[model samples]
Target: MSTGSFVSAASVENHGVVCDCGLPSPVRRSWTRRNPDRRFHTCKGRRVENGYIDCGFFRWYNQGDPSGWQFLALLEAREMMEEQRMQIAALTNEVTTLSMNAENDVKSKELGNRCEALKRDVQVLTERCIGLQNVLIASTVGFGAVFGVMMLMWTSNTA
Candidate 1:
């Protein structure tokens, strides 16, 4: 068929879909225009044969533009690139989150160790203070007894 009109395509969702003659043709992909983006396909012949259809195959354009296969390849490549970019972004975010969590864990462990060390130091200091208090009390009692004896001896000598 000679290229005349555009080959427009549309998607239809149906549980039971059939061709014009009621023949079953499983859908390929959701549906896409043959060359509606840039060029289209149409029949140049009259609509008489093939059950009032122009030609068995429609005619779009390929004179100035690229072929349909080329356009499809380009579209597929773009889709793959988009998916790859999304994957990379997700992986980067995961790595950053993991690093932050690791750093927090280390800091928490260090704080816990410091708290334990401080508790041990407090225990040691409290024990030392108790020992010093006991020694002070004993020294005071001994001094009082010695002074009492000294006073008694002085009184006796004077008498």
Candidate 2:
């Protein structure tokens, strides 16, 4: 059986086996190409702050390799899991991009509305200024005419 890659077996009962360190070994499963689902015993060690330290004990739980059909099924299952993980990652990226685009679209629309409102305000202010200027010119012309009439009346009384 292959010994390159192994994973911890979940919910596996202990087999009353002890290593050189007098610790009970835990059952694990291999994931290598040669031994896809082979179970074995590995030293159960305490976890330190950095990592786990083991007694370097190892033993095979199963007698022989799995049949041809079983090996093929395990390989196929592993491939399917990898493909699903890749698909999930791609979908997550797509969702994030779409969310950002939606936010930018909303901000653009708000800015456009603000620009239009400012333009309307400027137009209203310009119209009011023009109206005030016309009123000032009319008042100035009326004052000039009143002054000319007063001067004519004064000259006639002096003569």
Candidate 3:
């Protein structure tokens, strides 16, 4: 195809440019080892997995040499930004985990303290119950002794 068939980058509408095959052009990344990061517009037919033909609608969205220092710097900066974003996400997840663990630890300590207090209360109640039982036994024995002495006096007077 002659170069005239391809529209200049500025001449094409940003939203609604179609290829000669009557399909919209999609911006795609170049996977060539030499220019992996370069972007361009092409026909969707080119991406088909079946035995389909390409429309050859080509235009460089990032028009520059992939080997140039400025382009390489831009790519490096993009890679660094992605790495930083991933690090931020990982740190956020770690912070959430640590926060949950700290909260659980505090709750466990409080539960243990409550359990100890309940045990001490139960010990005090048990001591009180034992004291009450001892008092009841002593009173019963004293009453029996007084009743026996009165019965002896009455029988002696009658005899």
Provide the TM-score for each candidate, comma-separated: 0.52, 0.79, 0.61
Report the CA-based lDDT of candidate 2 relative to the real structure.
Answer: 0.83
Q: lDDT value for candidate 1? A: 0.59
lDDT of 2 by residue, 1-159 (tens): 445575756345668977778877777888876777788887777798999888888888887867788789999998898899999999999999999999999999999999999999999999999998998888888888888898899999899
Residue-wise lDDT of candidate 3 within 1-159, one digit each (tens)?
A: 233232323324334667778877766555433464566777666445766686777777767757777567766776787799999999999999999999999999999999999999999999998998898888888888888888899999999
Kindly provide the TM-score of model 1 when superposed on the true structure, using C-alpha atoms: 0.52
Best by TM-score: 2
Q: Give the better candidate number (1 or 2) by lDDT.
A: 2
Q: lDDT per model, in order?
A: 0.59, 0.83, 0.72
Enumerate clash totals for all models, in the order shown: 5, 0, 0
Q: Rank the candidates by lDDT, best first.
A: 2, 3, 1
Q: How much does candidate 2 score in TM-score?
A: 0.79
Q: Name the regions of candidate 2 deviating beyond 4 angstroms.
A: 1-6, 9-12, 32-34, 47-52, 63-67, 148-159
